[model samples]
Target: MATQLDLQEQEQLDALKAFWKRYGNLVTWLLIAALAAYAGWNGWNYWQRDQALKASAMYDELDRAAAAGDADKTARIFGDLKDRYPGTAYAEQGGLAAAKVQFEKGQVDAAKASLTWVAANAAEDEYRTVARLRLAAVLAAAKQFDQALAELDAAKAAGFEALVADRRGDVLAAAGREAEARAAYEAAYKAMDDSVDYKRLIEAKLTALGAAPAPAAPAASGAAS
Candidate 1:
């Protein structure tokens, strides 16, 4: 019985060795792959954190330059920020901030370029929408009516449909397309919520276009008992 037990144990050990010989390289490679992936994930997270810290500091500098009304410095800092950390929210905010300063300083072309970059490359849909809206306004002011309308067309964001329509109306009005302008204003007015103060502005636009939304009809009186 002792000899039989030892033989069984040896057979088990030999079977385990055969299995290892057949699958050892595959198991080793799989473990190496998993470890490499985990390390890469950790490295990527660390790099992103480092980038955000640097971008935040750069954005602070950009904000100061913009606040001081130094359009040139603002543009320069924003350009550097964008080049180094274009994926960061700070870069998007810096672009928008720099554009405002540039626009205020009558650097219309520079402003457009900044806005265009944000419109094209911003990570968030809302930022891109805002950039396009501002770009449209700038283009309209420059009498680039077609380009303005095109920008407005591309400014689609979930909650910004009314604003886009309103901007479209403004661009059409600028281009002397009164009919299209009135239609766009009416659409904007209809889409805006009654509780929004900006809706009142849209109403005013419709009124200006002589297409004021009709007053809600009075509810029918209940039949007399």
Candidate 2:
């Protein structure tokens, strides 16, 4: 019985060795490739996190300079952030902060330039929308009417549609395009929720333009154009 058991054990060992000989090299290479890929992914994640941390620190410095009312420092720090980390959210935030500081200092051209950079290069969609809106406002104030309208027209955020329309109305009114201005004001007024205070302001604008709001339609059987 002992001899029989030894023979059975030897047979099993031989079978295992034969199986390994057939597939061992391929399995070994596959495992090595998988381990290499996992290590590469981890390295990339670590690199991205390190870059983001550094970008965030630079943004904090830019914010501090702006808070202290040092436009020159803000500008220099923001430029550094943009150059090193243009794809980081922190860089876009710095651009907005720099533009605000510049605007406060009556540097309209500089503010516009910063906003334009953010609008074009922001890594986040929301930040890009904000930059475009602020840039449009500055252009409107500068009486760059066509450029302001083009900016507003290119802005496509549903949440910002009403505000863009209102600003467009303002620009049109300034340009003495009374009819287009009235239409834009009407669109803004209709888009705003009834309970919003800004709705009242838009209504006032319509009133001032000698453009009365259209009467409410009956609940049923809506009129066709």
Q: Per-residue alpha-carbon lDDT of model 2 for 93-174, expressed as tens digits?
A: 9999999999999989889989999998886777888898899888988989999989888777668878889988999998
lDDT of 1 by residue, 1-225 (tens): 579889999999999999999999999999999999999999999999999999999999999999999999999999999999999999999999999999999999999999999999999999999999999999999999999988988888899998999999999999999999999998888888888899888888888878888998999999999
* Weakest lDDT window of 10 consecutive positions for candidate 1: 200-209
Model 1: runs farther than 4 Å from truth?
1-9, 218-225
User: After best superposition, candidate 2 residue 133: deviation in angstroms?
Assistant: 0.8
Tell me how many residue pairs clash in candidate 2. 0
Alpha-carbon lDDT of model 2? 0.90
